[model samples]
Target chain A: MKPAIKRIIFIVILVGLWELGSRLGLWTELILPSPTSVFTALYHGFADKTLIWDLIASFRRLAIGLTLALIIGTSIGILIAKSKTADDTIGSMLLALQSVPSIVWLPLAIMWFGLNDKAVIFVVILGGTFVMALNIRTGIKNVSPLYIRAAQTMGSKGIDLFIRVIFPASIPYVVTGSRLAWAFAWRALMAGELLSTGPGLGYTLSYASDFGNMSLVIGVIIIIGIIGSIVDQLIFQRIEKSVANRWGL
Target chain B: MFISINQLNKQFLDKNDQPTTVLKDIELDIEKGEFVSILGPSGCGKSTLLSIVAGLTSATNGEILVEDKKITKPGKDRGMVFQEAALFPWINVIENVMFPLKKEMSKQEATAQAKKYLQMVQLSNYLEHYPHELSGGMQQRVSIARALAMDPEILLMDEPFGALDEQTRTRLHGQLEEIWIKTKKTVLFVTHSISESIKLSDRIIVMGTRPGTILTDIKVDIPRPRREHKEDMLELEEHVMSYLKKEIDKVVSEELNHETSH
Candidate 1:
């Protein structure tokens, strides 16, 4: 068998075994729900207005946080890239902070902003912005001197130079950074929802687990994974591949 | 008044707080509609000299005037073609050609102008092709077209065809000669290729390294659109080689010695 086919069949067999084992009474249906039961749970989630509200709440937080990160990070990146003083001051700090996980900020975030969605948004921004800044700065700095020289020769200077040459040339790297940031932010949001327990997918998971409805918990976990993957594959991955992979810049 | 470079000097600071001269007290005058080539070996600072003249870098001590205006900085009067094509990958061929003009003209005007220059380069069919999509020769043609579209007072090229294959380079030589005759633009082209210097340049400035300076300024009296490898071309090639071979050998052996010592 082809390697890809073999891998697919192996995964199918594993999932099938899990389903069959639960059905055969090796584990209770409450703890390890059948795939059918989880699919039903997913259906029930969409059948109400509550799930919509949860999604809106989560999305709104993600939107606000990510947007702020984009603006601030991009500005910081440009500064660091353009100035040696800025790099000396902030570059090391950024490196240190990026190494420190966003989850590590949760306790402090709770202390500062409380358990509201603001705290979650704050965490997301903290998770996302540094990655974007570092990548943008790196991309800008790595730009070929030849390109800049050519642009100068063509009478491109100042904003014209940046807009025409620097930004477009650095876009592929920016997209890569953004994809990485989105993953970090999304995972952070999920963890935030799980811990904070206000509303959203994470809340739903905790609520199901609290109620000892393990099947619903399993269902929520699958839903989160699917949503994350879909967003990555459909949106960020597509953009990254289009800009970075195809060009090989 | 097309271009004048007076007492051009450039210095670089070495690792030990010592200043090293790259180009020395050079004086050059380029009249309107002249084609000049600077010839030198790798470390001879010919590229540095060209870059300084083009206003890509500041001359440590000198003045460059394009059309009687002191060129302390880069301007539209000078259009430069890099050693690499250096076309922005995101933009298509036409867009790359149109870039210098887009800020001045309307989209329609820029498009027309871009199309005109692309046509000159025989790249009208590849207008929508991205930089990576085009062959190296095609990309360099686009680069030339991009510079030509600017309609600058002078064209500055830094070994622009160095990376190309010999056949493609020869083809480009012919195309470039045709374009030069058609446009009559002042050109200051830099190259290490002796045949290329003889073929393209009206005047050749041979340079020497180790505090780089002009060694000789030999005029090629050949007519435009001359055959590249004919007996006369070979004789001129020999003349250039006679000057450059010793310098090239010295630089190569010095480099090898340095590497071995390291």
Candidate 2:
């Protein structure tokens, strides 16, 4: 059978089993809501435009945070890559900071920015920046020495050399960095949104749980997983593959 | 002399921080539009000499002068082709050729100029092909085209065909010879292959290892196309080989000594 067909059949069997268990009163609806009720809750949430608002709010924060992270991270990466003093000092600091989970900074971020979108975005930026910086640093450092020498002999120097040779050569690393940053930022966003009083997927999931609406909570969880996979597999993975093919990395 | 080297010396600090001489008192001169080859064994520092001339490496003592101007660093007037081609993997064939020209001319002009040189190296059809997509020989050709496109006063090639297979190397020799004849750029070619130096150069400077210095500088009186004069080519090749054989033997004995000591 085709892989897609097989996957559909597998999903059907799992959903059928869940529905059968629910009908047989094998478990409380609060603990294990049937797939149908979850889907119905998803439909109602979308119909009332709550899910739409939540998605927009989450994506907006993600866009702003990710953009800021990339710009700042790339600059820091280049600085640490080029300067010995910076590499010894700032590079070591970034390495230390990278190991700390993004959620660990939530208390500090909330204290600084209050319970708002700014707090969530702050956490998101922190989540993405260190990894991006490290990846960009590695990317620049790993560029072939031959290419630099070749460029030098061709009259390239300073900023011009960086832009023309070093930056372009390090693109594979940059792509990888962005992909990682996106995943990190996404996770941070959810964690940050949980504490913030906002219209977001994380906020709604928490609200549903608080009200004991198990169907809504399950539906939101499914939506989050689906969106995460779709963005990573469909967008970032495709970009990475094309870059590898083009650059022969 | 169009290009002159005066008492060039280079020393590198070994792992023990002990100074080790790589090149010593390497005095040489080349006239305008002359094809000169520096022939040596693997560790002879011939590439070092070429790098110094290209201004990619600094000489510990003395200096190199092009048109009586001291060369402190790499410049557009001198183009270098590395052993591995070193074409940027991110760029296509035409872009690689146009890279050096970007500072010198407008985009349209650079494109046209790049096209002209790419044609000279017979890679016009592969203009859009990325460096990774091309064969080793083809990549080297793109590098040569890139160097030629810059229209430098001197071309310094460091064993440009050293990595290629025998058949590909022979084919490229023909192509390189034709390009040299057509452009007449003052060429400083470095190679380990004795016949390659003899085939392509107007003069051959044979170098010896262990504090690398010029062993001999022989003028090739053989006329172009050199393949027609096989006997003369063989005679010159044998003469070059004999000079390098002693150096090779010395290296082998040294290696054996080191191994036994270990």
Candidate 3:
């Protein structure tokens, strides 16, 4: 068999063992629901259609947060990289901001914006922007000085130089930063949902746990895992490999 | 005249904040279409001198004149070919060559001119190839072609073939000679290799390190298309090597004596 197929089979076997263990009463149903029971709950999740709405709402907010983070973060990153004064003053502030956990800001966001989309958006931006800016600054700063000199010799100056040279060179790092920020934002989203109690996967998971619906909680957990893996495998991982492998990053 | 460097000197403050001179009082005059090589050992400030001519680095003192005007910055008039063949990796061979032309020409015109220059280098077939895809020698050729495409009056080469293997270097030396003969641009080449300096230069400037100064400035007193393995070439090569050997020995012993005394 192919190695990839073998790996898949190995994972399936481990999951099968967990299911068997749960069914054989190694733990209570409350502790470890069987795979079949989880699947059943997931099916009921689809039947309700509220779960879909929750997913769409969360994904929409995520898109806004990520978009805002990209524009603001990259701009700041470029500024900090280009100017010594900017780097000294703002770069230190960015470093300090990055060290603070996103969860710590939830109450502040809620206080400022209330329990709506803005609060979640605020959390996502706070969680993501520091990583993006810091990585991008580092990336732009690391561009070979010789490369810049060569470009300058060719009469490339001002905006044209940045567009043709600096932007392309720094893209691999920006992509990497976005990928890292995605994982951070994902965690932040869950924490925010749990506390804020809106209609999202995290909120639904919390609601299920509050109601003692272990099966529903298990179903939400599976959904989150599947979606996270899909995003990593299909989106960010492909971008990283394309840059580092094919483009000689 | 093409360019003139009048008493050029470059200095930097050392760690102890003492002024340390790299090149000292360089005075050189180049007529139009002359090929001169600035030959030196490492740390002799040959590259720094070239950079000063190219206006990529400040001279720290004195003036460089291109066509009787002071060279305060890089312009289209003076093109440069670096040691590492600093081609833009993002652009293909043709685009790399056309980079300088973009400021003055339309995109289509720039591309046609780029192709023409590539053809001059016999690299028309490799127009689509990226810098990394080309061999080291080929990449350096692309750098030359890129500079040539600018239609500059002078070519400042800082050890352009210094990184290639023996066979590739020899072949490129011949090719460069042919190109220089055909184009007739004022050229200033920096090289550590004695034979390379002898082969390509109309005049050779041997610089000594540690507050670098011109040790010798000798005209080749030989014709172009000089071969490497010839008997006559070997005689002249030996003369240069022996001369450099004595100077190097003097330098080494002085440093050793200084060390022992300290």
Candidate 4:
């Protein structure tokens, strides 16, 4: 079977099994909401504009958080890549810091920014920045030394060298770093929204669960996964494919 | 002298901190618009010597002079082409050829100069093609155009055709010879192939390995359109090969000793 067909079949089987189990009363409705009820909840949520509002709110945070992460991460990465002393000292610190989960920053972010947008954004930054910096550093370091030498001989120097040669040559790696950073930012936003009280999918999830609206909870979860997949497919994957084509990757 | 190397020596510390000399007491004077090839065995530091002359690498004890000025760093006076084309993959053929020219000339002038060189290399059809889209031979030709577009006083090529097949190599040799004659730029070429050296060079500088030093500097007196001088070319090839064989044997024996001892 074609891969797309296989995927559709698998999803169908999964939904079929869930529907069968619900019909058989194998589990409580609260534990596992029926797919039909979840769909109904989704339709009602869309009609009331609650789901769209929540999605917009989450996307707004993601846009801001991601922009900040990219700037800070790329700068730190370039600094680390260019300086041997910085690579040796700060590189090790970053490696250690990256091991801590994004959720681990929740307490500190709350303490620093007191349960506001700042707290959520702070957590998102902590999640994405290190990963981006580390990947960018690797990308810059891995740029072919031959390219540098060739460009140098051609009268390229200093800032010109970095901009014309280093930056373009490291495109594949930098794009990959951005993709990973976006993923990290998205996850951090969801985790932060759960605790900080925001108008987002995470906020809706927490609210629905608290009210024992299992169908709404399930509907929101599906929407989150769908949104993530859509962005990856439409944006990040498109960029990666074009880069691969250009570089003959 | 248009370009001169004086008492040049290069040494490096091995992993154990022992001194390892790569090139020693290299001295040569190159006239303006001369085609010179440095021929040697694999480890003979031929490329190193070329790099030092190009000011990409520094000599341990001496200095190089171009037009009576010391070469402390790479300048527009010298253009270099490596074994690999090393063209910027991000840019198209015309852009890459135009890159070095951009600093000195306006965009239109640079593009026109680039177009002329590309046409000289017979790559006018590929002016918009990316480096990756071109074959190895085509890529090397683009690099030649890029170097020529700079209008440097000297061209330093370190085995520029080393990676291509025999057919492509021969064709490039013809193209390079034609370019050299037309441009009349001083060139310092490095290669291991005696035939390649004999075909294009006005003078061949043969070198030996293990503390690389000049073995002989042979002048190719066998006039231009050398296709008519096949017999003379063969005799020079044999003479160059005779000296190169001793160096190759020494390297082989050393490698065998290393393996046996290990």
Model 2 Cα displacement at A237 (Å)?
1.7
Model 4 achieves a DockQ score of 0.67
lDDT of 1 by residue, A1-249 (tens): 899799799979988998798778897787678877877777887797566777888888788888888888888999999999999999879999988878778888989988888888888898889999999999899888888888888878899889889987888878888888888888888887888856787887888888887777887787778788888989988888777643554
The ten-residue window of minimal lDDT in model 2 chain B covers: B235-244
Candidate maximizing lDDT: 2
A141-242: candidate 3 lDDT, tens digit per residue: 887777777777777778988888888777788889999888778877877887886788889999999998898898898888888888988999998986
lDDT of 4 at B73: 85
Question: Is 1 or 2 the stronger prediction by lDDT?
Answer: 2
Model 4 regions lying over 4 Å from their true place: none
* Candidate number that wins on TM-score, 2 or 4: 4
Docking quality (DockQ) of candidate 3: 0.54
lDDT of 2 by residue, A1-249 (tens): 999899999989999999999999999898989998999999999999999999999999999999999999999999999998999999999989999988888888879888889999999999999999999999999999999999999999999999999999999999999999999999999988887777999999999999999999999999999999999999999999989887777
Higher-DockQ candidate of 3 and 4? 4
- The global C-alpha lDDT for each of the candidates, from Candidate 1 onward, is 0.86, 0.93, 0.85, 0.91
lDDT string for model 4 (B148-234, tens) is 898998999999999999999999999999999999999999999999999999999999999899998999999988988999999
- Give the 10-residue window scoring lowest on summed lDDT in candidate 2 chain A: A189-198
A243: Cα error in model 1, Å: 1.1
Go through the candidates in order and give each one's DockQ: 0.70, 0.79, 0.54, 0.67
Error of 2 at B127 (Å): 2.0
Between 1 and 4, whose DockQ is larger?
A: 1
Candidate 3 interface CA RMSD, Å: 1.9
The local distance difference test score of model 3 is 0.85
